[model samples]
Target: MRRLLFIIIGLLSLVACKTDKTSVPQDFECFNQPHIYIKYKQPINGYTVKVMWLQNGEVGNALFCLEKQEVQYYYFTEKWTDKILYDKGNTYPNNTVIELDYTTKLKSEEYLSDDSPFFFSDVDFDGKEEFIINRYKSGSRESNAYDVYNVTPYGYFIQKTEAPFTELENGQCKFDSENKTITIYGSNGWNNIINKTYQLKDEKFELIK
Candidate 1:
């Protein structure tokens, strides 16, 4: 009888441990995490990825990668000013970027998982930070594709799709802020390697020696 009781207790303990992992803890600080990660499972091929990174206590930006669709971008402010809903078909017209609210009751997986490839940095040496998200890495060469955005003073994201920014799509960047230059390392064709340097000039990237 005691052996059966011990087995029952062990099963109960296993159930309890699983319950803990799946639910949000009561003391979770929703807005002030490293990066907000919320996963919403879909009924079909894949799930949606919603990630918002807070630069300060007040403002940040978010990226939405819905399956089979172009990735959408939005910015947020004052923590609760923008509320991002997980459901589809909500409308924002004219293809302009909008503000997404930062309201989420879901427990963030930021602490449970490793840091994602999302962050804010001063990539232009303009003393203002830019947002960078590494969308994916290509095969073998591990070429990294990036979405780099310049944040406006009014909390907007203007995507930089020009020269050096375009160069960053398939290569890794090492920024030298003091020298105001970017060194790129990437491959052109199979078995052909390239190392190039570019200087940040007039808010543009110019290829130099």
Candidate 2:
């Protein structure tokens, strides 16, 4: 009887462990819903500029801001230096400035000059925004790379790409609401590329050749 009771207790423990592993919480729901339209505001040049979030997609405005002082100096000196001052007011009118401390995973204290424009857009229709970030390497021109992020409603970048690449150049992206298509065209290498249309519904890119 003692051995039978011990075996029953062990079986009960195993069953409990299996239940714990497979149980789903009451409030758990899959996060696959489409995003609604949203807007954000920031202080620019003593006034406020309103930036709107993309609807049914990911990707927002390009962020243009003064790099933090220590970071700016590091980029120029190539050595880690703490001697620098950050000027906030010396910025272009149409340029959008965002705080690196707020959005990115990188530590703000390590870098130098940070005054590069980070381009971002909703290239994929996945209701999440992607970033074109600028990084100051040791000896290269300030590098531009692409990143993706799942942002919150309060303008915070949540999940981001682990690695980013610098393949595409800067250009304007326009979406056709009527046909659910996107048109991207600008500079590619030395020549001016034009009229590259992407059909959103079909997920195909057609280059006018």
Candidate 3:
């Protein structure tokens, strides 16, 4: 009887241990929290990539490689950001130049200029910076791409760009800092033209007309 009781106690102890183990959550488990998703098309490779940012989570940035059919993870903190490419049970090398190119284009213009790329600067002097991208036609045969960037008190920078302007069309920008919004003025060389605004909130960027 005493041996049987000991066996029962041992089983109960094992059960208790399992219960305690499950009580503590694993750090790597996904919490399904609110996050932001951003998508952009690569100018060089013509690949559609998705960027995800988990708001207030451990995973700072995650990239989905649509062309290569893979996923790349990045850990970002206030000081630095590190990228880890998961491939076949091993980490692959990160294409920082390609990533930076895509990110710069996404942040500013759709078409990236090979000669005069877009720039960033702090135009409003509000400590927060902005982006400036140049737009020009390939057939124009004119050096129309002019971009610049200026530093700001805030961590980010500001941007400015120069393009062709007509009497009916003028260059202007509209900003909404509270919602992190940016707008660009478009011209059709004639009438029926309107200003367009873009909002960058929660990792998603949308064009508002």
Judging by TM-score against the true structure, name the best candidate.
1
lDDT of 3 by residue, 100-151 (tens): 3243433343222332223343433345444333333212232233333333
lDDT of 1 by residue, 91-121 (tens): 3321223333322313332111112244455
- For model 2 the TM-score comes to 0.27
What lDDT does model 3 reach? 0.35
Candidate 2 lDDT by residue in tens digits, 24-88: 44553212111121112333222222221111211222112222222210000111111110223
* Number of the candidate with higher TM-score, 1 or 3: 1
In order, the Cα lDDT scores of the candidates are 0.46, 0.31, 0.35
Q: After superposition, how far is residue 124 of candidate 2 from its true place, in Å?
A: 2.1
lDDT of 2 at 65: 20
Error of 3 at 91 (Å): 52
How much is 55 displaced in model 3, in angstroms?
47
**Which lDDT value does model 2 have at 27?**
54
Worst 10 residues of 1 by lDDT: 107-116
